[model samples]
Each structure stands twice: as structure tokens, then as C-alpha cells.
Target: MDFTPPQKRKAEESIVPMINVVFLLLIFFLMTSQITPPEPFEVTLPVSETLGDAESELTLHLSKDGDVQFEDFTGETAWMRLGGRIDPQTVVKLRVDAALPAPKLAQVMQRLSPTGAASVEIVAVQK
Candidate 1:
């Protein structure tokens, strides 16, 4: 007759590998994700029927108070900075506040004409 206690089981498997796999997946998502930075200034985009994706490196921002912001520059300085970056072939993405008046928008367009913009696309939300 056998009267012996069962051998002790090994301790629970180490969770280090699971943790490593979880970290690896987290890193994969972080690398593969496209994260757009927050806008330097808040804006309420106008609604329109225009439907197309334009990914321009340079974006021009016009606030409801007619403030201008291009990349990190703001106000008159933004305009000057924009001038140096723009050329006849540069596509400028203009994000104007919805509350901004039409006249102000027109004035902006007029001023942009002198910058020799190849094309200026107004960023808007689709209806």
C-alpha cells in the first residue's frame, strides 16, 4: 500500500511574461497610432458641404476676434511668419472661427492674396 503525500506543485507561473506582453502591445499601439496635437487656440469651424481630405503641413488659424495664429506664432507675428513659409505652390489650410464675420474673412482672403498662396482651403465641418 502506498501512503505518500503528493509532491508540492510549483508556485504559480510568473506574471512577468504577461506583463511584458501587455507592455509590448501598449507600445505597439502607441507607435502605430496617429496622434494629432491639440490646436494652439480654440476655434469653432463653419459647416459646409465640401468633402475632401487635405493634409497640409501649414495651417492658418483665425479667431472670432480676428486674431491670427500660424503654427506657434500669433497675431501680426503670425502673418509675418506665414509670409516666409508661403510660396506660389504652398497650400494653406485656413481654420477660421465660425463666429467671425464675412467681411473679416474677405479681408483675410484679400491679405492672403499678396502672400502668393497657391491654394487656400477653408477648414470646416461637414453638415
Candidate 2:
């Protein structure tokens, strides 16, 4: 019998389908991801030209209408009630509307004094 040159075998694996499946999985994960909205607050902070760097542990939003809200804290309580039992070592952030009266702001600060709150930082947009 005559012997001829043996043929080379081709690779058995096909990578196209595997690549497509990987891309599909990536897209599915991105679409199914959850996006949460920021907490609701009523205050409109005034702007500042020069702001300092500070880390806020708690945020208190006071609206122009005299409504006060506590954010970044767990539990529901009025501003005055909240001041009674806050950690003294944590920093407090006060975000107040630019239009709010100075007296009201002072009152709010006074209420926060009794709380063991470490220090108060005021945040506002640049005017």
C-alpha cells in the first residue's frame, strides 16, 4: 500500500461563543445594579467663596420656613429632641438656608449645645 503525508488536525475549540456570553453577562449585571437617591432635605445652603476642608459626621438641615431635619442619624426625632442624646465625640454639620434669620440660627445652635456633640460645622454654598 502507498503511504501519503498525514493531514494536520485543526483545533477543536471555538472562542467566539464564549466571548459573546461573557459580554452578555457583563451587560446584564450593569443593568440589574441598584442606584439609590440622596436623602430628602428642605434646606438651601448659601454658597461660599472659600470653603475649608472638614469631615462631617452628622448633618442638620434647617429650611427657610423654620423646619428642621436630621440626616445621617438613625431614628426619628424633632431637632430639639435629637439634641438630648447625640454622641459628644461626633462632629455636627448645620446646613441652613441663606434667607433664614440670624436669631433662628442662634436658637438652633443653642439647642445643639446640650447634646454632647463634639463640634459644629456650618455648610453653605458660595454666595
Candidate 3:
């Protein structure tokens, strides 16, 4: 039987285009993703040049009306009903309206300060 060698199949093309497309998609997503800024409450905060030194792993906010809110890692509301996940081992940032009465603020601060909280910083909103 006369058999010519079966025609050799063309070698597979390189996947570089597919890889590039994937990388481009990844970069596009990274750039296009929306980033939420910090929430705005009604009261204005006092500014401090030294405030630049204030850093926190978690943030708690006390509104002027005596309402409390918490911020999660994504900087979104931690949900008062669901409560918050605070690690006592780390510093929790406390933001209070400048107008809130000191005793109320102190009580709130005491409640916030648990064994794991590394430190407490009372932050005032900037006007």
C-alpha cells in the first residue's frame, strides 16, 4: 500500500495573545474598580496639623445626635445592627462630633475600649 506520511498538522499557535488579553483585562479591572471615600456625617470636625500622625486600623463614629456608626475594612458602614468586628489587639480610630457632650462621648469611648483595642484616638471632623 502506497502510504505517504500523513500530512503533519500545523504546530499550535502561541497563546501570547490570550495571555496579553488576560493581563489587559486584569489591568482594566484594577483601574476601573470603584473606590468608596469616607462617609460624611452632619457635624464638622476640628482640624489639627498633628492629625496627620493619626492612623487607625479601625474607625468608630459618634454622631452629634448620639448615634453611633462603625467603619469596616473597606471603609463602609460596619452596620450597627450587625455590630462590628473589632480586634482588641489593634488601634481603633474614634471619630466624634465636636458638639457632642463630653460625658456621653466618654461613655461611648469606654464601651469601645475593650481588652483587644490597642489604643483609642478621638478624632474630630474638619469643618
Candidate 4:
């Protein structure tokens, strides 16, 4: 038999490029993805000088027609869900439509007070 050892095959192909492409695709998707959930209904937010992003864990939405919605809840069910989620220190975030009447808003606020929320943050758009 020949004394020479068999010729070695070429080294395994590098996977670095594949890994980079995968990472790039992942980043692209993340950048284009929507982080927040879709609104239950279309709402035109009022303008405010102190506009800020809504980051509250417990969010309540009020439509122009005085419809209240919380997550998948509505009407009395929404209120009950909101009340149950509130505590002595929980700050509830309210997204009220710009066209909502003042009296309707007051009624909502009146209902909210007994929920035991320490504060209510009304989210609005910047001028």
C-alpha cells in the first residue's frame, strides 16, 4: 500500500455570512414590526401641550360617541374589568376621542373615581 496519507478535503464552508444575513433579516423585521396593539376603534385624539406616549399597562379607550372599551371588554364589562385591574396606586391611561362631549367625559371620570385609580393620564397628541 502507498505510504502517503490520503489527501485532505477542503475545509468546511464558513457559516458566518449565513449568520449575518439571518441577523440582518431579524433586525429588518423588528424595525418594521408594530409594537403596540391595534386600536379597538378609530379615534381622533385631542391636542395638548403636554403630549407624551401612552405606556400605561391598563388602557381605557373612549370613542366619539361615548363608547367605552378596555381591551376586549365593552360597556359594563369594560368598567368592571378596569375596576378590577385598578389598585390604590395604579394610574389608568385614558384615550378619549377629540369629539367626545364634556358631559360624557365627566360621566366616565365619575365612574372611574370609584375604581380606586390613584390618577388618570389622558393621552393626547402634540400640537
Task: Please list all clashing residue pairs in model 3, or write none if there are none.
Answer: 45-125, 45-126, 88-116, 88-117, 89-116
* TM-score for each of the candidates: 0.85, 0.61, 0.55, 0.76
Model 1: worst 10 consecutive residues (lDDT sum): 49-58
lDDT of each: 0.90, 0.75, 0.66, 0.92
Ordered by lDDT, highest first, the candidates read 4, 1, 2, 3
Better of 1 and 3 by lDDT: 1
Mark the regions of model 3 whose C-alpha exceeds 4 Å error after superposition: 1-34, 38-40, 47-49, 72-84, 125-127
Q: Estimate, for each residue in 2-113, the C-alpha lDDT of model 2 and write its tens digit.
A: 6997898988999999999999999999999986447556566778887865577567778776677775443347665567547868788777888899999898888788
Q: Candidate 4 has which clashing residue pairs, if any?
A: none
| Positional deviation of residue 85's Cα in model 2 after best superposition, in angstroms | 5.7
Query: How many steric clashes between backbone atoms does each model show?
Result: 0, 7, 5, 0
lDDT of 4 by residue, 26-88 (tens): 999999997988999999999998766666789999999999999999999999888889999
- Candidate 4's TM-score: 0.76
What tens digits encode model 1's per-residue C-alpha lDDT throughout 1-127?
A: 8889989998898999999999999999999999987787789999988677766878999999888898888988999999999878999999999999999999999999999989999988999
User: Candidate 3: worst 10 consecutive residues by lDDT?
Assistant: 73-82
Error of 2 at 70 (Å): 1.1
For candidate 3, write residues 8-35 as lDDT tens digits. Answer: 8999999999999999999999999987
